[model samples]
Target chain A: MKIWALQDQVLNPIEQKSIDSFKAAGGNGSLETFGNDPYKQKLRVAIGSPNAPDVFFNWGGGNLKEYVDAGKIADLTPVLDQNPELKNAFIPSVMDGAKIDGKQYGIPMRGMQPVLLFFNKKVFAEAGVQPPKTWDDLLSLVDTFKNKGVQPISLAGSQAWTELMWAEYLLDRIGGPEVFKAIRDNGAAGWKHPAVLESLTKLRELIDRGGFGDNFASVGYDMGGASTIMAQGKAAMHLMGSWEFVNQQDQSPDFVKNGDLGWTAFPAIPGGKGDPSNVVGNASNYYSVTSDSKQLDAAKKFVSTTLHEDSYVQALIDAGDVPAVVGVEDKLAKAPNADYTTWIYNTVKEAKHFQLSWDQDLPADDATFMLTQLQELFLKKVSPEQFVNAVAAR
Target chain B: MQSQRPSSWYAVPAFAFFGLFAALPMVLVVYLSFTSWQGLGTPTFNGVANWSRLISDGEAHASMGRTLLLMVVSWAVQTPIALLIGVWAAGKQRSRAVLSSIFFLPLLLSTAAIALLWQALLDSNFGIFAGGPQFLGDPDIAIYTVVFVISWQYIPFHTLLYQGAARGIPASLYEAAIIDGAGRFGRFFNITLPQLRYTIVTSSILMLVGSLTTFDTVLILTQGGPGTASRIIPLHMYITGFSGFEMGYASAIAVLLVVLGTALSVIVTRATGFRAMSSQQEGS
Candidate 1:
């Protein structure tokens, strides 16, 4: 079998061990990995090469959408039909991202919701404050945490993705999916839209109120610095996603487990157009077959086997991912942040709309433009009106 | 001339070097500047469209302006510091070689490695000091950080060049200047400065050219961000071609960079009387 599979973040020790076992079993498969790189312009050179692996991991929205539009990948509707028994194996909306114009072109494999709001249980206990259920409560909690000599949240405001997520949370909770769709589809929002302005204004207030850590703008998202404030109990809450589990697993694994790690939906806006349950993302990352694969059959089989097999699901679970595959609740018993995964899985299962994360769903240029605007606005270089107008013009 | 073939055609080798390395790339770039090509497909002629787009493109112009500013500031910051250090080390013969080698250490390291090292050192988290400045993140300070790192790496190169030139100056001239009551500063300004004109001009030209195309260091340090605050021209071109996937537009920017580089070289050469210095070499 001429087989090659491309995946990102699937090269950890656990996955490496599984690949070795697969090889030892006399399966002829090669794995090529793309490590969380966002620049599709560079990726296209690889995708268009003569020897591109049959199956490669990519983002579902713009990246896969572009490849599908270019006719670079196979329509996996037939594959889904063949595996009718496993039709509901993956989360529906996450799988929806891989579909284009009503045909499934890619299958959901790995997923993560890395930016979650994690509160320090110890801080909460000390301050005798409850995890806020509403946006007003959260705002109040920030002041309470500060009064208790602890920060409320750790924010890498300079990291464009982090800042963009701030806007997305506010949009989902206040402006709703219809408003987001309108704005994304047609730039339809006025500069003075309350939801649009409130998101930026609230973030600025958070900064001014010392909710984010000292020099938070300078820290990287995954680095220990941003997470340190939460991990050390110096902060009461951290707005991050599943990636923090990896950072926490090595230091205080128990803190991540046993109800100490709290996961909540981003707080609701008091007077917003959007529903609070309109979560901010679909599948976080996906793998797809590139256009230049020499071993199409092998590649398709590898993807089919890897994603459908129990071993692969188990392997991914051990690697700190919230797997899209269903019926693996038992395998997740040992997960350090099983509660967080359960919360996301349960919430995603019933969500009415899977709002494609704005940063990844938009055209590459437009998304980059958004990221730039977010950084500029967060740094207070531009006003909220200017930011809204900037994105609208672009 | 020898009875056989004359060896005076050394200029042929020089011309060959320029043809292979410099002239051909220039031709390719100029041609590419006129075509709409995405790195993969066949080139389609687009006339002056790319240039026109670059004219109105705020991002392109901003990046170009930043590139020129970086060149000026990096060279200005690096040259005088390097010259002063070179003179100081040369005066202290015992530690001159050690200090010179240490100073030029950045030159010996790869640009990416140096940039990454500095990034880590300047990182707000887990850097040398607690809460180090956002050298690569904050828009307000990113450009200066980039300049500081660029100058840090280049000072040693120019220092060594100046050191060699200063040592080459005849001791007798310094002795005569000292006898004529020219103090240390006076002797340096009058004797050392006049004699090292060729070395200084050559180094200046090299630095100016090097700064114009500096890519790897700035790329690693910031990737030209906090919203194009520290982005130089080459970086802008790379993003346009590799990130934005607009290879034709990137090529246009590249061609313009060549024009800018050439124009700046001409202006600096005129200002520094570099041609006059070269003529003096021939006359001697």
Candidate 2:
């Protein structure tokens, strides 16, 4: 069997170990990894061709749904039903990411990545301010950072998806996850929801008030532009994924080692409908079997047996990943960067809802259009009303 | 005459290759334009749906406008600088060769490398000009930044063309112009300008069509961002087909590009009388 996964320095070795162990257990397969963008493109082409892999890595939302809808994905409902322990080992919320139409199609394979408000503790200390707990507090802090000659926030606006985190949190806070669920299930008309408009208007006001600063549109996350700015004290805060902690450790070891990295939940909106504990980002990546795999049973066994095993879960924890496996709290606490990892684990465990990123949850065409519109909103090329109207019209 | 011309079989291989690789794919693309395929399974025929969408897509129109602007601005910015440097480099002075070699450095780098290098250098936060104007960020300024980067990358190649043409201008023409009391400016205008006319036409055709198809640089530089400010035709088509998985609509856009490129070359050649070839020396 052939397995495809994303190229990552840390995850690659861990995955290889799992594949090696699977081979030792009388299973056969090799893992091939690719960069993020190229991997997505290659999977789309490969899945429809004769060369499709037996098991492939996927972000488990509308991205996987496309394959499911095409009848190209093997249904894993029976496998989970046959072994309730395998189903119960993973967190229910993260597992639902790959659940479509009440049928299981994928197995959780990696960490939970929830977007958080990460701040430079040293910068916050110099400014004599704490991370905000309310929308109004966030607004005032923006001014405070600007007055101190620091960019209030470091945003990698060159890629629209980075800007998307703000919108995701705001909409979830203001009207709760139901608003986005409507948008996802009902298509473009769902953009007309009042909650979306209100959140975007509020976001626009923040942009106008110089919250992200002027040059954000040029900053990029992948190149370490925004993160470095925040780490070097040029920017006071950065809203990013959990993976950012590892990135900072790699790029600016002194910064992370000094305990200058601080994080918190997104600030609550005044009288918002959603619970403050609700979260958004990638819930977790999954490994889904292709419908046409030659070694279907072995591939299914590989994903189910290897992912939740004691050794595989420990390897993930040691690599700074908070895997979706249930009851790993003590292991996480004993691991490196325990404080941050434990907090994430608890935060996800108690969350009322864990919404997937909208781009990953919506169809490709709508997501692409929404991202462009979102960039225009951030650039002030279009008014909030115009952004809503343009998207709804699509 | 046919017998004297060595068997026609010699041309068979070239025709066969072109037919398979070029002609066949083009026909398939046109067929794809009339069908809906999400880069999966088989395409189902959808008639003129994609064409109708293309006619009304405001984004496509805006992208077309940007592509034309890039072609025009890059041509205007590159032509004069390349011509001047090319003429100067054609001089026999030892310093000219060294300086010319240095100027040709950008041509040595791959498109992706040049784009990534500039992306770092112009990074708004940590770049050389950290606090300066947002060259790659602001929507209004991003497109021009793209044009500037494109010119920086291609001007050296154009300069190489101009340099060769300038050298081929016949030193005898310059000597005669000097004898006729024509100063530097007078000789350049009357002799060099007219002599390099054909080369200018060839370079301009390449420039215009090249800009029309320019993808990787803008893709790597801004990705048509700061809110689709620099999105051009080719990039738009790519995002639609690959990113959005709207292959049918993207094929329609591709067909439009093919038509526009062919028409541009034809118009340029016709307007410049380039088809009427002749020797420009004192005697043919």
The best candidate by lDDT is 2
Against the true structure, what is each candidate's TM-score? 0.88, 0.98
Q: What is residue A390's positional error in candidate 2, in angstroms?
A: 1.6
Best by TM-score: 2
State residue A383's C-alpha deviation in candidate 1, in Å.
1.6
Instruction: Give one digit per residue, the lDDT tens place, for model 2 in A166-253.
Output: 9999999999999999888888889899999999999999999999988888888875688999999989889999999999999999
Write candidate 2's Cα lDDT for B1-284 as tens digits.
Answer: 45577678999999999999989998999999999988888899999999999999999999999999999999999999999888888889879978999999999999999999999898887778878888998788999999999999999999999999999989999998899999999998999889989999999999999999999999999998878999999999999998899889999999999999999999999999999967698778
DockQ metric, candidate 2: 0.81
Across B126-181, the per-residue lDDT of candidate 1 in tens digits comes to 67755555666677788888999989888888888888777777787888888999
Per-residue lDDT over A1-394 for candidate 1, one digit per residue giving the tens place of the 0 to 100 score: 2223334444444445545666676655555443344435446665556655566656677656656765677777776789776567887777877777788777776664534577788789888988877878888888898788776887765467776767777767766776666665455343346677777777777766777755666666554656665777867887766566666766676676555766677777777777666676546556566545666665555566566577777777766677877766777767755766677776776666677777666755567667767776766777777887777775
